[model samples]
Target: MTETVEPFTWHVAQDAIDDLHRRIDATRWPERETVDDWSQGVPLDALRDFVDHWRNHYDWRSTEAWINAQGLSTTTIDGVDIRFLHVRSAHENARPLLLTHGWPGSILEFRAAIPRLVDPEAHGGTAADAFHVVIPSLPGYGLSGKPTRHGWKVEKIAQAWGVLMARLGYAKWYAQGGDWGAAVTTQIGRQNVAGCAGIHLNMPIARPLPEDLAAPGPDELKALAALQHYQEWDAGYSKQQQTRPQTIGYSLVDSPVGLAGWIYEKMWAWTDNQGRAEDALSRDSMCDNLMLYWLTAAGASSARLYWESFASFAPAEITMPVGASVFPKEILPAPRKWAERHYTKLVHWGVLDKGGHFAAWEQPEVFVNELRKTFAAMD
Candidate 1:
C-alpha cells in the first residue's frame, strides 16, 4: 500500500484561536434549577468557570507552538489523511512501537512520555529499550480526517495501522493502546499481521464469562457484581453513543463547552478524579482535548464509530501474545482464567494500584513499566 506523505505543520492558524475566543465569549447560557445535580448533564456553574478561563486566560497559540515543538508528519492511508507525531530514537537499532489514542484523547496524551519511551536515557533508562514511536490521531479525532463511509470499524482501522507501519518500513513492531485504542490494537494482535510482534493494552474490554468461569468464585462474583452495578448506572453513555450518536453529537459539535462536559463527565466518572476533575487534570489539558474535537468538528464522526461497530463486534477469542495492565477504576478487569478465555496467550497481567481508564495520562510510570516488562519478555 503506497502512502502519500502530506505537508504536516503544527502551527494552528491565529484565526482559529480567535474564532474559539469569540465562541467562548458569545455563549448563550441556559438557566438551571439549583437543586439539579450533575446527573442531568454538565453543570451550568462548571461550564461558566471553564468558559471564563477559556475566554480570559487560555493561550491556544502557545499550545500549538508546544505541539509544533514535537516532530509531526502526515500521510494518506487508503485515501484518508492521517496526522501523527513521530519521535525516533538516536539509536538506529531501536524497535518500532505504534501507540494508539482513544476517544476524547489525541496524540496529545502521550506528549509527556514520548521522549522517555523513545530515548529513555534522559529518563534514566537504557537506550537498548529505545522505541521509534508513531502516535496517530484516530480517524474522526484530532488531525485525522473524518471517514466519509461507514466501514471505519476497529478491524479496518487496525488494517490501516498495519499499512501505516509497513509504509514506514517496519516489518515487525510492538503496539500499545487504551480505551478504543485497545480495541484496535487487540484486533491487530488477532490479525497477527507480520509487523505486529506483540501488544500491551491498558483498557482491555470486558470478556464475557467462559463456561468454566461463569460459575463465579467469591472474587469473580464480586467483580461481576461491581460490573453489573456500573452497567446499570454508568453505561447509559455507551448505549447513547452506540445508538443515537448524531443526535447528541449535534450540540457537542457546535459548542466547545458542551463537548467538554460530554467528554469530561466520563473522565470524571471513569478516573480517580477524587470528585473534582480539575484536581487530577488541569483545565488547559482538558480544554486542549475539547478544542481538538471542536476544531476538527469530529463529534458526530467520533460517535458514528460506536454506531458502526458496536453491533457487529462479537466477543471472540484472540490468539496472540498479549499483556494487560488492569487499572482499578477501568470499565472491567478479568481474572487470569477469564482473560485467558479470550486472550489465549496472555503472557502478562497486572493489577495496577492506581489510575483508571486514562492510565497512561494519569499513571504513566506504572503504565510504562508494565508495557516495558510485557514487550521485553516477548523480545
Candidate 2:
C-alpha cells in the first residue's frame, strides 16, 4: 500500500449533467400521500418542489468550486481509495482533527463547519481554538472507493482513519462524528488509535441496559421511547438496506428522483425542521449533497455499510477520554447515564438546547463550539 495523497478535483462531464436533467424531467412522480403530515413519507408535492430546485435553481458549479477551493486529495488505504478534505490552519500550533460523515450524508456535511474549525479567530474563537481539519467521505460514500469485498465494517474504517492521520503526519489528534462516523470514532477510542488524544460524539453508541429496561428512570424511559419509535416507525429504510441493498440500488442509480426522494425523506426525518427540511438546511446545500450521490452512483455501495454493521452496534467500554452532545431530535440521543456504561473516561457531557441528527451540517456554530470545549477539556 503506497501512501500517496494525490490532489483531486471535480471535472464532471457535460453528458452526466445532461443525463441527470433528462432523468429528472422524465420522472413519473407519485400521487400525494394519504396523510397531511409526513406520516406516509416525503409528500409528493414536497419532493416535486425539491427536484424542481435541484433541476433548475441549484448551482453545482458553486458547490464544486467551494469544495475544490478548500483542497481535496485521495490516498489508497486497505486496498481502497479514501477521498478527503485536508485544510491546514494558518495557525501553526493548531491541533489536527479528523472529522467523518455518515449515511444520507456526504463530505458536504462538514463544509460549513470546516472553515470555522480551521480559522477560529474569524468565527467567535481565539487562535487556541484553531484546528487543521481532515474530513473524509466514508468508504463507499461520496467519492471514496467502494469496497470490493465483504469486510469493510466500522472498525475497518476506524483503523484506516488512524492510518490516514498518521500518514498525514499528525502525531497527536482528536476525532468527532455523528451517525456511522460516530460509530467509527467510537471504535477509534475503543481501539486506542495511536496519538489520538480524545474523541467526541453526538450520537453515542449505547443501548438500554438490562437494569434500565427492567426499571425505567427518566433518561432510561427517553431512550426506551426513542428505541420503540425507531423500531416501529423510523426503521423501514434500515431494514430494507440491511436485507436488500442491491435491490434498491437499481432504483437509486437509475432515477435521479428516486435517489433524491430516498435522501430527501431522511432529511425531513432527521433534521430539526419546521415541517420542511429547508427550515434547517438551505436548499442549495441539500441539492449539493444530492449531486454527490447522483453523480457517483453511490446508492447501493453506500447502503451496504448498513448491511455490514447495522445489527452490531459493537457496544464496548472505552477507556479513552470522551465527550458528547445530545441534540434534542437525534434519532436515539443516548443519555449520559446510558453512555457511562460504555465510556469509562467520560470527560465532557453537553446536552444542547436545539439541533438534531446532522449536528455539524444542521448547527455548525454549536457543533464547532462543542469540539473546542470538549477537546480543550480533554487535555
lDDT of 2 by residue, 45-87 (tens): 8899999999998778878888887779889998999989999
Model 1 per-residue lDDT tens digits across residues 1-379: 2376545786666787788778766777788746666666667887778777767877776677776666677888776888887777898888899999887677877766787788778876787778899898888888888888778898889998988888788888989988788888878887886679888888766554576355777647766866786788777877888999889889888877677767878767777667767766778877777777888889988888888777534444678788888887776655566666778777899887788777877777777778777877787
TM-scores of all predicted structures: 0.93, 0.98
Show model 2 residue runs off by greater than 4 Å.
none
Whole-model lDDT, model 2: 0.90
> Which candidate number maximizes TM-score?
2
Instruction: Say what the RMSD of model 2 is.
Output: 1.1
Residue 20 in model 1: lDDT? 73
RMSD of each: 2.2, 1.1
